[model samples]
Target chain A: MNPVLGRVFPGLEGRSLRAAAVVTVLGGLVGVIGGESVVLALVLALAGSLATLSLRGRPNPLAEEYGLLPAIAALGALAALATPSLLVGLLAGVAGLGLLLWNAESARDTVRTAEPVEGLLIPGLGLAIALLTALSLPTASAAVGAAAFAVVVALALVVWALQGALTADPYAAKAL
Target chain B: MSGGSADPGPLKFRPRAVALFGAAGALAVLALATHNAVPLFLALPLLLGPAAAATGAPRVPLSFRVTWSSEGSRGEVEITGRLTPSAAGPSAGVVPTFYRPEPLIDRAPPEVRSEAEGIAFRLHWSAPYPCLVSVARPMLHWRDPLGLVERPVRVEGDALRLQRFPPELARASRAPLRRTTPLPGEVRARQLGGAGEFFAIRPLAPSDTLRQVNWRATARAGRMLANDFRVERTGDLLIVLDLRPTSLGSEIDARLASVAAAGAYGLAQSFLDQKARVGLALYTDFVESIPLASGRRQRYRLLRALQAATPGETAGPSERLAVSLRRYFPPGVTTVLFSALADDESTLVLPHMRRRGFPAFVLSPSPVPLLGQLGPRPTEDDERALRLLRLVRRRRIAEAWSEAAVVEWDDYWSLSSLASFFARPAGRRAAS
Candidate 1:
């Protein structure tokens, strides 16, 4: 397994493929809320898997190499806000976290994978979008969607944390 | 042996080395200021490439094992580590180093080398003293990319410990004899004559009984042959170990304990070699009582007694050595005592054994030289002090064993000294 970040989430190519599939699912779901849902879905889907790959260990791969990762995630956050409605943004956000656990039961080899940080960041970006859209519109649907998004992300966060704590840590010993 | 390099790998940045980065920054500044794109292009990647590569370097798992091999005081060890197979990214490695406080005189730690089969190496070591092989933690040399910085990553794994036990005498070169007991055994006795293991058959004498004649010989060319046999006597012996504290470091103290163990193991070994029944008992702190019996198991009894002979709290007076001997041991059974003879109680053991009617031999380890070897160096003043110390030590030893045959084992604790000591006129009579 990859030493720090990759140790938590290992299958890169498969996860990447899943991320694409998740984007299609997310896009169709968000389309119900209308207004740039396609773009929002794609961003959230990619960000969720990325967070799954990176966020688990200390300075997951994206955050470790350079400031490059934070920059990309921030850009995706900007894209999430462009969605027309808070409902669309919230749906995209919650979907990313839920999808991180979608196939999590079949723990994959983390050697070439990213960190698990994506689980938090994608939802965090969604949250940012929900706040922006909620403030701009102040509609009951926006408030309800924001509340639902917050609840889902909070639950996902707890489960992700508990999972990290429970995982059996296998150590490597080298001759000195 | 893997070559040891003091050069710190490129994980930490030194001022002199950091000057290159400073130089790169300066060139970039100079290029823009002088309107030249050449230096900027070159310096830009120089600044970014390593940081990028270090980030992307594949992280791999490494595992290791520490194994021990030994024969008496000398042996070798194998320490090997393997990286789990991976095709994810570029190769990386771990270099581990074992740590210790005191320098090993002739022993070297395993050299670390990363190989396809994994990193492994072997090292030979010789330490004849009793010790805990080691308790120090190991560390690994971790380097980032481009040999620019090196860091120490403390390696935490299941501890590897090779218990260093005192040397056990391997040869029964000298056999100590004991007085005859009722049990039938292998010790030959001069006074006791009976039907025994066949010694020889002679021509039938006129007075020879018909039952004593060998029928086969009578039937053959020989007219008659009287069967003759040597009386086989059983002897019982007990080895007493002193368990009082010693004034020395653990290593030397262990050596002293080992010396005591050597005496006990050797004596029991020698007697067992003669097929005489032997038992072992401890004092200062009372250990279990083992009854006398002749067989292969007696060796095991002696060894277990030696292990019990570890240094502990000072208990009964040295005279108890005799009291204990008298209480448990049978009359006429010879008692061999291994003690430092440094204390008042110990000083009385020899006379006690003699007075109790048990043939006694005392093997007391001389402490002065061993003290000098393990403790502080001896100067003229130190020598004078030692001489004073020696007078007291020897006086006490002499006081207890004044009328008894005592062998004061000195600097080189070996079997030859023991053999020769026992073969001396006094020791020979004591054995008989």
Candidate 2:
């Protein structure tokens, strides 16, 4: 195994074969669920399958470390296709949201470990938006749900906008 | 006491503050619509925005750790760091930062824009959520990127102390005529005759007691030649290290000290290998002494002591070394003083010890060109400094004695130079 790839995705080389098998089964399931829309399901499943396979040989340890993000997205997308009911769609949406939150948390940990701060404003606001969106979606009407979703999307955009500004300066610690 | 001692079951997260502000804004808006009250709703975001921002903040728990290889070289060492988040909610997804502040011996600090591999995840959903994030880097240095706030964390680890010793003469080529004066309790070699102080006479050889042996002289010489031998016992050697702040400059001083310490350590090891007893003494004006002792254990102790020696303000050249030396060293033991010939105060006391017949070897670190790079100086100051340094060099040359050996180490190139110089068969034959 390439040292760089191994480093980027610890244990990924070993799991590549397993990941391929699981992805194949998941892809077939997606195709079965699409029914009349076989071509669309096949394409999405192929995209997800390729991502999973490509992650197996990612040459950067960080890329491998973050490989879970795409995997989670693919799984959520697959679940949404497999069961098109509102409940299943909601569950898939929640799962996708959970994966995104997980990705954000991982990114935050990477930042905090490298550079620590008293509080993180962007991520906090993002979490707030997610919580409010999730809670209001269940209790309120479609219009209210849409409003909450808009707020969540807006917060995500705000956080994304602040990424460059929030980048911790390497020499900032030495300033004091 | 009971009321005060009662536990506040895990801190509550209340939305009342947000609700109250929202209510007040709603009332203000209603009043505005009815034209009855002040417009307070305009302040809603100013008040509730920061409060909501504060509430949503992630409490990240950070710690630093440092580790190095056992080998004494400043090569690449793996740095492992972990950052754990203590809050759940959306805050658990935050990416923490890591960095190494000090420069490693072999490798320079990694490029500023480089990124590290890290994992962040929540361990549980409890009140204080613990999220763990781990990262590894070839060299230690990193930072965290959380918007609006940044924290710096440093990890302390084992620091490798790389040292190389001055080379010595090979044993095979070091042979020289052994000189000794025989006394009542001295060990003797069965040689035909000897020179120097007299010893008891035995029967003369066939080629012996003739012309220069007069009747009285022959009587004294008997049948044997009047042979003498000096006592051949290994002497105790004590190495004294002066760690005064004034003795060194900030940058090169520590390296100078380390070099001197390493030299003394190497020489002591050589002496021990030659069956000599070795001891060590470290002194500064404030810290009086680390007493001298002899043996393998003492050698290890001295190395450790040397490692711990730090320059301080209280120590200077004029400080009395005799008081400390007298307290720890045995009478008439050979003493080696390792110092940077920086101040005249230390030079003042050297004559007194020489007067006492102790062979004092002064090993001075040769000042190098690195000092010039440390800071800017006037051209006149540089010229004056060079002139003063030359005078000091002359003084050291003038002060050289039969019992003293002064060695100046100016560059890394000089170690092999000196070793080769001393190891020459010609020098050994000439000295003998």
Total backbone collisions, model 2? 53
lDDT of 2 by residue, B194-280 (tens): 343344554445654354233565666454343333323334566777666554466555655666666666666665544445677
Give the winner by lDDT: 1
The CAPRI-style docking tier of model 2 reads incorrect
Model 2 misses residue B343 by how many Å?
3.0
Instruction: Tell me the TM-score of model 2.
Output: 0.42
**RMSD in Å for candidate 1, one decimal?**
19.2
- Evaluating just chain A, the predictions reach TM-scores of 0.32, 0.37
Show model 1 residue runs off by greater than 4 Å. A1-176, B1-68, B72-106, B111-173, B186-234, B246-255, B273-275, B285-287, B294-298, B374-378
